[model samples]
Structures are given as C-alpha cells and as structure tokens.
Target chain A: MKTTETPAPPPAEPGASVSEVAAPVAGPPRRKKEGAVLNVFSHGVLVIWAIMVVTPLLWAVMTSFKDDSSIFGSPWALPDRLHFGNWARAWTEANMSGYFLNTVLVVGGSLIGTLVLGSMAAYVLARFDFPGNRFIYYLFIGGMSFPIMLALVPLFYVVNNMGLLNTIHGLILVYIAYSLPFTVFFLTAFFRTLPTSVAEAAFVDGASHTRTFFQIMLPMAKPGLISVGIFNFLGQWNQYMLPTVLNTDPDKKVLTQGLVQLAVSQGYKGDWSGLFAGLVMAMLPVLGAYIIFQRQVVQGLTAGALK
Target chain B: MQHGKYRFIVGFLAVPLGLYALFVVWPFIQSIYYSFTDWTGLSPEFKMVGFDNYKRMLHDDIFWKSLQHSLLFALVLPIVTISLALFFAFMINVGGRRRRGGPAITGVRGSSFYKIVYFFPQVLSIAIVALLFQFAYNPDSGAINSFLRGIGLGHVQPLWLGDPSLALWCVMAVLVWSTTGFFVVLFSAGMASIPGELYEAALIDGASRATTFFRITLPLLWDTVQSGWVYMGILALGAESFAVVQIMTTGPGGPDYSTTVLVLYVYQKAFRDGQAAYATTIGVALLVVTLAFAAIVMRLGRRERLEF
Candidate 1:
C-alpha cells in the first residue's frame, strides 16, 4: 500500500459523514414519533447552546466599549456609555490598523493565488487519466497529514534564503503555498463531480483545455470555487504562527500576532479596554465577512464533512 | 493531441507543484536533517552530533510534562467535545418531532438560527477566542466569576486560568467552548441525511432517545463520529490548542509552566532559547506521537464495524 494511503486525519471522508446525514429527507411521509415534548426539549437545548456560544463574543464587544477600570467595577454590566476611544487608541497607537492592512493584503493575495493555481492543478488532476496523476495528487494531499510546525525552522531557512521573510508579499506566497493542499484536495473532488461531457464538448468545439477550464468548466465549478475561496480566506486571515515566525517586522505583522503582542503589552500596562478593542479589531473583518457569506463559508469549509 | 494533453497537465501543475516543493516538501525534508545535528540556526558552521539532542530530550523533565499534558488533552478533550457535539447535534437534527404530530423527522423550529449562532466561534480567529476567554476567565472580574457570584456560588469561584491546579482544566473548557459548535453543525448535517424512517423504526421498537442514538443514529454515523474523533485527536495533539496558553497564561506557558504543552515547548526552544536543533528533535518526537496516535485511532475505528 502507498504511504499516501495513510489517511490524513484532518478530512475524514467528511463528505460521506456529512452528506449521508444531510441527504435530503424530502421523500415520502412515514409514521414517526409525535413527541411534542422532544421538540420542546430540542428547542430548549439549542437555545441554551446558542446563548453559551454567543454570550462571550457579545461580552467582548461590550467590554471593548467600557472604561478600562470601570470594567472591574461592573464586570457583567452593559457599558455605562459607549467609550469609542478604545477603538481609536487601538487603531492609532496600538497599531491594529497596520496589522489589519497587512492581513488584508496577505490574505487577499493568498486567496487569489490559491484559487487560480489550486483550481488549475485540481482540474488537471481530476480530469486527466495520466501517468503519475495519482502520485501527484497524493503528494499534494499528503502535505495535510504531517504536522506543519515540524517544518517551521527549515521553512524559515528556505524563506530567508529566498529573501522573502518579513515582507507582506513573502507572507502571501507562503500562505498561498501552504493553502494549496486543501484547496487542491477539495477542488479536485469538486471537479471530478462536474459532468465531463461539457468539457469534452468544449474541447471538441475548438476550445483549448485552458479555455475550457476557464470558461466552460470554471463557471460550472463556481460553487466549489466560492466555497474553497472562503475557506482559504478564513484560514489565512486568522493565521498566527507563521507570521510570528517569519515576520519579525512589527509593521508587517498580521492582526493575530499584533493582538497577542498588544494583549501582552497591555497585560503589563493594564490597558484592558484598549486590549479588548484590539481583539475586536482583529475579529471584525473575518466576522463581518463570515456574516455576509456564512452559508458559503460553512458549506465550503464543511465540504469534505458531508461527502 | 497526446502531446497537447501532456503540455496542458504540465502547464497546470507547474506553479503549484513548484511552490509546494520549495516551501512545504523541502522544509519538511530539511527539518529532519536539522533535527539530527547541533545547529544554533544562525551560523553556516555546525557539527553533526548525532543523537545528542535526542539524548537530551530523554532527560528533559518539562518535555515529559508537556507530553503528559498532550496525552491528557488527547484523551479528555475528545470525550467532552464529542459527547456534547453529538448530543446537541442529535437534538438539533433528530430530536424534533413533526409539528403536526407523527414520526416525521424535522429539525427544531429554529435549527438554522441555532446553527449559525453555535457556529459563530468557528469563524473567529483562535487568538481572538483565546483573548476573549482571557477576559472571561479573569479571576477578579471576569464573566465566569461574576456569574458565579450572581448565582450565590461565590464561595466556589476558582481562579480559573490563574490557579495552577485548575489552569489546564480552564484551558480545556475554553477549547471545548470554541470547537463544540463546529462538531454540532457537522453532526447535524450528518443526521440531516438520515432517513426519518429509521427514527420511526427505533420509536416503534420502544427505544429511548439515548438507546435510539446508540443503536440507530450512532451506528449509522459511526464513520462521521470516527472521523471527528481523529480530527479532535490530531487537534489535541498539535500546538493549535496552545493559542489559549500563549494568550492567557503567564511565563510563556505558566503558572510555573502548569499549562505548558509540547508544541509550546518546541516554539520556546526554537525561537526563545535559540536551541534550534534540539527544538527540531522535539518536533520530530511530536511528529512520531501524532502519527502513532492517528494510526492507533484508525485501527480502533476499523475494529468496530457495525455493518448493517
């Protein structure tokens, strides 16, 4: 058996697990338990859970707006009045704005690069019955199984040798590179599900494979692309370890590392409210993006879970 | 056309394959090499003092302590996270009876709303979650203590992340809080596709919710649960869980390193101590443990086959 046959623990035939359970139950009516008690119980459990999940986040937002010392006096109280100064101080003095811009640039570049290159490779691997196709496919997927930090020191060496460390573009390239395995794995599965006749027909009609992929095929694979795109966006935006290791330049640090440093500094200085503001700043973009594309983010991320 | 196909594959594969090789594959290969030698990671000159670092690792008390922590997480986090996730997922997906009264399975009235809120943490950065929890777990004025006081349980309030005895448990609780909703959504989706007839059959057979969950839902979704187990195990083993430790704890991973974990040890060794080679040795040990844990889990999963 190939070493690659050792299943990467990250993505269990997630599709099978999630998809099988999520299989549309739109068919015939069956005699089932008429338990109103169960329904009410389910609702109650779900409500409590939702509150448990949301309360901390809401509290963080509330705390970010309160006076730093006042928070100690009234821990659970809603802010007496919204102190918007924390946000300004966090952005201007604590340097969250810089981190935010750095994150946006890196994540943006990484997303586009990953989508284009990942989909290209995924299309070929999924479509062509070529020699070494399985080998290449496994090579990409195998990246996911191994612990990532094991490679950090050597990766630092390589990135340094290439003179890419401490640069936003450097971070972008690394993010894009690391993201490929999952993107390729996901999109390959997605592409294989697309009807082949369309691509075959496009080829017959004088379109090159690239054009077919770009025009006839990519458009068809839009749902998959959007799903994986959002997945990469979230993953890259929240990255902490890589930036911490590779980018020592404070100006280029991502929001995650910035917040940790800010929090640590504030922990010593006792600027609790401003620290909360930094956490909020680091949070809002991804949270805002998620709220807008919650379905796609959820669906795209959980793609393997269902199949 | 044959040459054209080759050309096309080459064109598509070139950039991604190159980047993967240069960044991921080569670094992985080189890290193994680095693990073997005594290199400070700064100079070009270094000696291959084979097995010396590995020898040191065998004696490091903190390393062993952190490994114990990793094992505890591997064992405990999965139990708590999976149980809650499964129970809640089952509740959301299959607990609801038909509104009109029958065995027709439907999700609770606001399952979608419940799902979105439950899944809110999955989107936020772990750093943010950890920081948020840092505030929540503040021994003096944090939400947890405040609530405890409000509930008239002021005497029982723990220092949470501050108290050395309770520190690791608080971290685990936070980890569970952040990740449980994700599995809930996952299991919900898994349960969604299960035929309502199965539940009806279980109901007709006089199975209780717990019994039906074990016999019908669980047996059917064992594969999903197994995968979830492996994923949880892997996460528990890795440094990702240390985001909270990195944020909330003092002394890098303290109350006197009470919450210290293996990956955090590796990070400290490489970056803080500048003992890069020794750090790589520890990384290798981590790799071995993670792979072994995954293998063991996979084998156990294959052993229990409820083939219907």
Candidate 2:
C-alpha cells in the first residue's frame, strides 16, 4: 500500500546474491563433451516415463469410443466411429449424476467451511501470542501423520453419534474438520510470511479485528489462500476413504464411490465401453480443474510437502 | 484491551478448535481405548477383553501376511519411486549445461510440458486410477496383455492383477505410477532452491553429473527428501492402500488375499466382518508401526544439513 509495486524488493539478507535471488535458474555450463549424450539419455528416459503416464488415459478414452468388439479386436486402432451412447448410458444408467451432484454439494460445502474456519484460526495464531497457540498448532500438525485408517472405527461412531451418518452434511463436516490440519498448516505459515504492516494500518483506521481480517488481511493473503484452496479443492474432491466409510447410501455416494461401483458392475457385466465412459465422466471435471491450476498444483504439492 | 484481545482470539479460534477436537483428535484417543474391547460396530454394549485382540493378532496368519505386504510395499515403494523422482527432478532442473557466470540452467527442453503431462494422473481420485489400471490389466481385453500380444510377445503375457503371484506387485506398480509425478515435482522444487553458484563452483571443480547429484543435490535436499520418504512410506500402510485394492482386485483382497494390506484387513474386519474392536486392535498396531517407521526413517535421514 505504501510503495510502488515493482516486484517487491528482494530479501534483505547479506550474500543474497543477485543471481541466486533474481535468476535462480542458470544457463548452459562450460565445456563438457559427455553432456550431449547425457541430455539424450535424460530425454529418452523422460519420454518413456511420460508415455507411461499418458498411455493408460489415452487407452481408456479410445477404448471408450469403441464398442466391445473393437476394443477386444485391435487395442491400438482408432474407433470405427465414436460411440457417444456409452457416455450417456454411464451418466444416466450408472447413476453417476446423482453421485456427481452429491460430490459437488459435499465438496463445495467442505471447501467453503474449511477456508473460512482455517483462515480464521490461521490468522489468530499467526498474529497473536495467545496462550496454547504453539500447542494448538502442533495439535493440528500431529494429525497430518496419523493414518486415517487408525481413526476409522472411532470416527465412524463419532459421526454417527452426531446424527450425521449417511448424509452430505456429515461428510462436509468431517471433510472440513480433517482438512483443518492441512489448511491451517499451510495458511499459518503463509500468514507468517506476510508483512504485518497492512493489518496494522487497518487497525489504526478504527477497524475491528474482524473488519481488518476480512477487508484487508485476507485479500493480502490471496495467493496463499488460492494455493491452499487449490490444494483442498483437489483433495476433497478426490477424497475416498472418509467418504467411503462415512457416506454409504447408494443414492448418497460421492463420485469416487459411485464410479467404483459402476466400474465393478461394468466389469462384471462386461460393459467395458460404459466403464471407460464412467471413468472419463468421473475424471473430466477434476482434469479440467487441474489443467487450469497446473502451476498451483505444482506449487501447492511441493509447498505442502516442505512446509 | 487485554480482555478484548482474549475475546478476539477466542472468537476466531473457537469453531476450528471444537471441530478438530471432536473429529480428528478425539477419534485417535477413542481408537486407543476401543482396541481393548469386544465391541461389534453396531452394538453399544460390549465386554472388555484386555489384550485379547492383540493376542489373536499374534496367531493371525492373515494379519501377518497383510503386515508383510505393507512392509514389502514400504520397502520397495521409496526405493523405486524416490529414485526415479530424484532422477527426473534432477534432469528437469540441472540436466542442461550452462555458460560460465550466466543465469541458472534451463530444465530439459520441454520441462513444463513434461511436468504437466507427468502430473496428469495425480488429479484423478485413486478410485479412477485404480479402475483405469484394472481395465488396463484385464487379461482378455486390457491394454497390457493386448499390447504385449500385439507386439509379438504373446507367450510371455501374464495375467497381471488376476494372477495370485503377480497381483500384489501389480497393485504396487499402480501405486508407484500414480504417485511418482508428485515426488518429481517435489524434488524439482527442492532442486530449484539450490542456488546457482554452488553448481557453478562444482562445475569449476569438474564434478560429473552423477557426482554433482549424489554429492551436492542429494545432501542439500536431504530434509525435503526425508519428509517425502516418510510420506511415501506411510502410504504403504494407510487406508489408501485399501482404496486401490478394493477398487482393482477381484475379491476385497483378491486371488486368496494376495493384495491384502493392513488397512484393508482392518477395513474388512471392521466393516465386513463386523469386528470393530479387533479392527481397532489392528488399527492401533498399524498406528504404532507407521509412526515407528516414520520416526526411524526421519531419525536416520538427519544429516548435518548444509547451510549455504
């Protein structure tokens, strides 16, 4: 708010070399005869790995376009004609719509609750020296390593006791609760890295803490919020274990569970094309979101790990 | 002012704290308590059977087998995935040779392209990956066998996930395939953090690529690598191990329990077999082993971290 935003000055530490801070990437090294060979070798390996990552999805898509006979005939050939019916059959007959809707409601609700609650908690912990702040922070950190399976039997009953079993609300509450650790973990660290001067100015302007946070600080923390938001969106959207154990009604099943059931049934009944369609249906939205936020996906996963 | 500060803190903190306590922290405490009882999942009433479940676990062959699978997964997953992750990340970040006293090295020719492509599988739910692989592994029409036969190798094409002998390894291969990209991205970030001057200094000293990786990159990225190790290691034993198996395998564990992991065993017992107490018993043991494995790895992963 004070100075012109010219890419904010580099960190104020000595020996923070211009190249190290500014251009962390380096150019080509000095003479090394074997480097060309190594580059080829690296490309060879990466290309093969890339193919490994890609082929299955491609295979599934292509297979989805083919009927049973074509898929069974030539694994490598293009479909004689695209079969859009498989996708329609999957969306309607497989009950994927109901599941997709349930997932949308649960994940959408969980994301909002998690961001609001997590940011509030993160803000307080980052800004104030409250009693038990360290303890509360560690309490959240401690949940990160604890296996979800270890807590399953008891968590089942906890949700049940709260009368939230077999409901979207229950799933949302649990998702928000478990996601708190990760959400708080990243946001707390992120909040700490922000300059406190902005919030101080807000406070001096006669704003309440709530007003300061919602109007000033939260927006300043937008990049952090987005990173963690992207992280949570993918995670809760893909969440399987908690939802599987928690949300069990056939109509109430999330997309992952529904897709699993559809896949298993399709396999048993030999609806291979329909199975492929179901897989694609379950995959497209998440894939679209991932593509849009590809940079954030990389940033969030790495930061989440290191943090 | 003091009173207002306290109120502000409580106002901000109350909801998250209450929910965390109820859902995350409390379940852990309850699981420890539940492990000793004989409570079926549905029954409110049960008798306390002290250490009986643990005793049963000692004689339980399936329990032992599941643990072995988890141990095997924990061992093999990091060796294969992390090694590949480090290699790819190193190549992406430092494989290119650069001019002296110039900007940092470029990644491989198409680094961002490769990264996005590599990380494609990551966004999908594990169930989607599992199902995709399951179809790909189907002996009759699946991609693996079909491709193998198409390429003039019909005689050696094995039933991948269906064969009892190959089932477990096939499942682990899926885990590796789906997970490796994230680690690659992780290691690349760590690689990016290593300043340009160190590589230049090392180049001046004539360090080979392998030597630079093992000597410079690996040591500097040790801590970041350790957490990733702990993560990949614990995944071997987590409920996630169940998701793949449950989605991909024939039975819950399939082909005579070949792909059964500890978490699957717990899920089966608690959910299918209705042995909630015994499942919690297994869950407790899993908790101990996972934490211990993580602790031991982190302890060993500690080195005199370079502070450049």
Candidate 3:
C-alpha cells in the first residue's frame, strides 16, 4: 500500500530542457575523446537495430504497392507503379469493409463493457470493507490465470445455447469475460492510488455511492480507464480465436479472422497482394492509437505487469 | 451508514460478479463435468464415463507427444524471448544515459523508433504472420533460402518449415520475433520504474554499469520478470501451433507431428475428427496443466511487495 511521493518539480515545463535539469546536479563531466567514441558507437548500434526492426514492415508496405510482376522480379525494389488499387481491391474484394465494421463494433462493445463493469468492481474492492472482499478480489485475480482456450468448448456450447453465435453481442460477451481479469486488476490498483478522502467527503455531503463513483471517482480514474480501454481495444480488435470459434458467419467475422479466411482462400494463387494490403490496413488503427497514446500505454503496461 | 455501505458494495459488485459467474465459473464447472461424461458435442445422451478418458490419455502417444512438445515450446520460448528482451531493454535503458555529442541515440527518446519497429509484428495478426512466413519459407520462391543461396550459404539453407527437425525451431523463431517487442516494452517499463536516483547512488559508490544493473535493476525488476514469464508462458501454451503448421506443413502436426501442440491436437481431434469427448478431455487436461503451472509459479515467486 506504500505509494511513492512525487519529487518537487524544478519548473513547470518538465520536458523542455534537459540541460536545465542536468545543470542543477554537479556530476562528472563527460571525457572529451572517450565520450566522442562511445557516442558514435552507440548511435551506430541503435541505427542498425532500428533498420532490423523496421525492415519487414517497410517490405510489407513496399510489397503492397508493387505490381504482380515487380513483386517477384524486383522483390526489394520500389514499385514501378504505385498500385493504390491494391488497397481498393483489398477493401472491396476481401470484404474488409464488412470486417472493419465488425471489428469496430466488437472492440467498441468490449471496451465500454469492460471499463464500466471493471471500474465498478474495482471501486468496490478498493474502497469497501466487506465480508469476502479480499476473497472476491482473489477470485478475479484467479480469472487472470484461467486460460480462455481451456474453457473454449464449454463456452462455445453456452454461446450456442444462448443463441448468440455469429452475433456481435456474443463476441462482446466473450471479450468482457476474457478481459475482466486484467481490467479489474489494473483498475483496482489505480483505484487504490486515489485518495479516499474525496469519496468520503462526497459521501458525507450526501452523494450516493453511485453518484460519487460516476461523478468523482470515474473521472479521476480516466488515465487508468484509458489504459484499460486501449489494452482491451487492441486485444479485441486483433482477436482471432474467440470470433473464429463463436462466430463463423463471414458477415459477422472480425478483421483478424476475415483476413485469415482471405489468406487461406487466395494465398496459393499468388494473390496475397490483397492479403498484405489488408494486413497493412488492419495494422493502421492500432499503430496510430499506440503512437498517440504511447506514453500512457507504456506506463500502464509496466505498472500492471509489475503489480 | 453501515447499511448504506453494504448496499454500495452489493451494487458495485453485481454486474462483474454476475458476468464472471455465468461466463467463467459456470462454464468451468460444466467443463469438469463434461470431462467426466462421454458427451459428444452433437448428442445430449452421454453416460458417466468416469476416468476412462484420463486413463486412455495415459497411453495415448499423440497426446503425450503433444504435451511434450507444448512443454518444450513453453520452456524454451519464455527463456529465449525474455533473455533477448532483457538484453535489448538494458541496452536501451543504460545506453541512453551516456552523454553522446551527436544525438540522443541510446535512450527512450531515441528508442521510440525501435519501439515502433519491435511492435510492428504484434500488430500483424498471427494468421498474417503465418502466411507471410509461408511465402518467406517457400523453397522455390522463398526470400530466406534465396538470400542464403545469394550469400553462398545455400548448403546451410534447410527447408525451414518443411523439415520436421527444423520446422519446430523455425516456428519458435517466428514466435520469438513476433513477441520479443512486447517483452521489450514490458522490461523497459520495469527498468523505468527503478528510480534514476538508485543508478546515481550506485554510480557514486564507484559501481560499474554492469554491476549496478545486476545488483540494483535486476533484483528490483523481479516482479516484472515474473509477470512477463507467467504471461508469456500462458500465451505460449494456449496459442495455435497449427497456424504455422497448417500453412507450412499442409497437415495437422506437420512433417510427422513435430510441430503439434496440445491445442492443435485438441482442434484436430474434436473439429477435424469429431471426437468431442476426447477433445473436451484434452481441453480439461490442458486447463489442469495451466492452472497447476500458474499456481506453482505464483507460490514460488511470492515475496513481500517492494516499495520503490
């Protein structure tokens, strides 16, 4: 329960000047010749690793633009003609438009469900002193360790019995179940970090628990909620197995499963240009979201993992 | 006030608790029951088979081999992936601290480029990765063997996903590449949590960079390490080995069951072969294994929480 206190800030603009931060601390100055050599060496290694990491993605992008002839003949070259139509064909032919819509609905449904329910559960666990509270918390933690695949068969049966198969609702329910563990774990930790005084003061002023949670607590837990939402979104968006098993109808298929079906059906015919294009398009939202919220996601992941 | 508190707790707990019970607890109970009974998926008439399936599984060579392969894959993947990830994280974390004249090359600021690169494969679906590797490993038009031939190492270019001996290893390499970035991100975050003051203190004490890392950083990040291990291990166990196997080998287990894992085996048995009871039994067994391993790791790794 011990929380680390933030240090006093040197200035309001924390990220503005590294020099200012370094200036206050008396430290050994870098040796001239040695620093130069190490600097060059470090940059050299980083550049090499960067190239290694970026190469395949660059290859995919380039390949997507390549004409069928150039794909094999000049495998590594820039396309002679930028075939933007490949993307258009992928969108139309691969039925990616439908798949994209399915993914959006599934991801959106799961994110909203997990965040709302998870935060409520977390609020109770963090702020309450009730019978079986600790035990209930552990139960949720145990859910984290439960492999969804183990429950795959029974889950399929249950979904079928509910007549929810091949529907967006069915996929959302499965995602909510699968995501509860991690989301609860994260939001619980985050809720604990919130000072209880605010909620208590609100309660003293006659605000109902629900009112306090929604108006005060939930708003305060925005970062945690966003982190959980992003995690759930990525997971749901990229998800393959649950949808594949529970929803086999092509119209109901999410992007991952849809792309898989497309690849399998057309891969051998050397028509994978569309598959690669679809793959690239599917990767866009995730990459864009990650880039925008890179800081939050990185911090959230680390904190969650360490906890 | 007391009554209000109780009401609050009940209200807050209702939704998640109900969902967990229905989706998780109920299904879990049903699975254990189904494992005991001889229930074909299509037929509701199933007798209480007792432990017959478990007994049969005792001598089942494919089940045993699949389990062995799963265990081996689980064992090796975590070690390899975590090691590589830790190395990269450490390099990025410490290497950034050294004052470089030209640019901030080795730190988080510069390392963002690497982050995007490493995480690229994660964005690609496993299916896409499987298909890509399929073409990449194609002997005739494969980029891998072609590169080897071009480099005068053609003899060393074994059929990556074709040869039974090399298929598992090739699959493992792809898994490693796909996942290493996730671990790198995890490890970097762990390293980030260790206050710069600790490193400064260690440096002031005349500790070398390596010594500080081993003594301060590694010990401090044990929780993250444990978390990464458990997460990766569970994923490695549950993931479909069949994706790559199906794409590369053209069969269930590929090149004589070398790449077969338990999930794929269950998939084939139940869906492909229509042995619902057998598949459910295998699923039950995998459940037990996963739970047992998780329990052991959690128990062993338990320590008093570290205050940063």
- Which structure is stronger by lDDT: 2 or 3? 2
Q: Native-vs-model 1 lDDT?
A: 0.80
On residues A127-233, what C-alpha lDDT tens digit does candidate 2 reach at each position?
89977999999999888888888787889998998899999998999999989998999999999999988888778778888888899889899989888888898
Backbone clashes in model 3, listed as residue pairs: none
Name model 3 segments beyond 4 Å from true: A1-48, A268-270, B100-109, B154-156, B195-208, B240-249, B295-308
DockQ of each: 0.36, 0.37, 0.28
Q: Using DockQ, give the best candidate's number.
A: 2
Off by over 4 Å in 2: A1-33, B1-3, B98-104, B304-308
- Expressed as tens digits, the lDDT of each residue in A128-165 for candidate 1 is 99989999999998877677778887888789988998
Candidate 2 positional error at A179, Å: 0.4
Error of 2 at B243 (Å): 1.2
Clashes of each: 17, 12, 0
